[model samples]
Each structure stands twice: as C-alpha cells, then as structure tokens.
Target: MCVYLLRGIAFSKDDSIPKTGKAAIENKLLAEAVLESIIGKKGVSPGARLSLAERLSQLMKENKVEKDATKTDNQDEANDVSLGDKLAKEN
Candidate 1:
C-alpha cells in the first residue's frame, strides 16, 4: 500500500530518501510535479489526491516553521557574545 502511494507520487529512484540539499530540492520539485500530474491523471480517486495534497501542504508548513525556528536560533547565537569577548571589549 505504501509502495503504491509512493509510486503514485513519483517515479521511484535509489536516492528517494534525499540526504543532501540538492537532492532535497529536486525531491520537492518532483513532488510539485506529481501534484500537478495527479490532478489530470484519470482513474485516480479525487479523495486520494485531495488527501495526498493536504498532507503535502501540511508537511510544507511544518518544514517552514522548523526553518524559521532554526533561523531565529542562529540569529540569537549571532547576537550573543562570550564573557571573554565582553571582558576584552571592556578592557
């Protein structure tokens, strides 16, 4: 069942589980294409396509939130100074 759903999404590749930035970007593009393809593909139930699209949308939202949090953490770290640095600056 899982295999069928994945195939419906896109053609299987050895690097399906992307491990790098480029691969992740490619996978996302592929997913967008799949969503577009499914809408016109015949024989697929509307419910299935809607469910898949909704899940993808949800995942994208979650990913954005996580990225935002990471960016905020990085900004906070950048604005922080070590005690030694503070002391050196005051000296």
Candidate 2:
C-alpha cells in the first residue's frame, strides 16, 4: 500500500526528485511541486526538497501514530481539520 501510494504520487526517481528510495521524501517533493505548481511553479533545490520531504514525512507519521492511539468510540466527533477551520484559514 505504501509503495502503491508513492507510485500513485509519482515521486519515483526520474520524476521530479533526485535518486532516493524514501517514499516520504518523494511524497514531500511531490507536495512541494504541487505547491509550486499552484504559485511559482519553479523547481525547488535538492536541499529544500529533502527538508520539506522530511518534515512532511514526520507530520504524516505523527498523524498516523496519533490516529492509531486514539479511541474509536465516539470521541470529539470532529476531525483535526474541519470545514470551519478550512474556511477560516482560507480567509
């Protein structure tokens, strides 16, 4: 599933990333590309790409770990990011 997700994201080597086997690294680069694609759309450097990738990877890991440790039975009944939050952030 992890590999499938990475493949779907298309961060594999020869894409927009340097030669690396780390999926999260690739995922981060892919994410940056999306962001740049929205705004500047310029290619980011290797260092920035790797750093962003690492940070994003850590965030994803933390989110998963938190979710796994959370109780399933009727918690807050709200997500971490709600529609209200999204609208507020957008504004």
Candidate 3:
C-alpha cells in the first residue's frame, strides 16, 4: 500500500500506516501512510489492525476531510442498476 501513497498517504486492502520518524503527522495523507505501515508490519494483532480504519476515519473527521469525494457520481450511477434489470425494464 505504501506504493499507492499519494503525497504521503497510502492504503491497502489489509490496512496499515507509514512511520514519520521525528516528524509530526500533520497531513491527511499521513492517515493513508499509517494504514500502509500497518499492512507492512508482521504479527499485528487482529483487534489492533481492525482499529486502524476507525482511527483513520476519526482523524479525517477531526481534520474535516471528506473521503466520500473520492467517488464520482458517474461511477455510482453505472452501478445503480444491474444490466439485466435495466434491459428487462427497457423491454
């Protein structure tokens, strides 16, 4: 997930975070990086890793950052209806 780090933010399917040694984590990207770091580490407890997503979400809320913007209207619109359903309705 560190590979997907955008401007210091990184994420992955497993969830993790990156370390900012000697530096203050001030950017929203840090949340992503943090997730990446968690994914890279070994032997992380299930409860601890599960907390990562919630923690990142809290941080984003505190910073007034909206992640919903990552999704586009067009993308969701396409999924609004199944192809078979649409075709049946059209017929």
Q: In TM-score terms, which candidate is top?
A: 1
User: How far out, in Å, is residue 18 in model 1?
Assistant: 22
Q: What would the per-residue lDDT of candidate 1 be over residues 1-91, giving only the tens digit for each residue?
A: 1112433443234425322232222476776675565554562456546655676788889999998776644767778997899999999
What is candidate 1's TM-score against the reference?
0.36
Per-residue lDDT for 60 in model 3?
76
Candidate 1 residue 54 C-alpha distance from true site, Å: 0.8
- Best of the two (1, 3) by lDDT: 1
Estimate, for each residue in 1-91, the C-alpha lDDT of model 2 and write its tens digit.
Answer: 1112333333434335534455453476876566465333254445444545675688899999999887466556544577888899999
For candidate 1, the lDDT comes to: 0.55
- The per-model lDDT (C-alpha) reads 0.55, 0.53, 0.54
Q: Candidate 3 lDDT, tens digit per residue, 14-91?
A: 655554433446766776566555544652344445554566677779666565655557978756887889899999
In angstroms, the error of model 1 at 73 is: 8.4
Pairs of colliding residues, candidate 1? none
Q: Comparing candidate 1 with candidate 2, which one achieves the higher lDDT?
A: 1
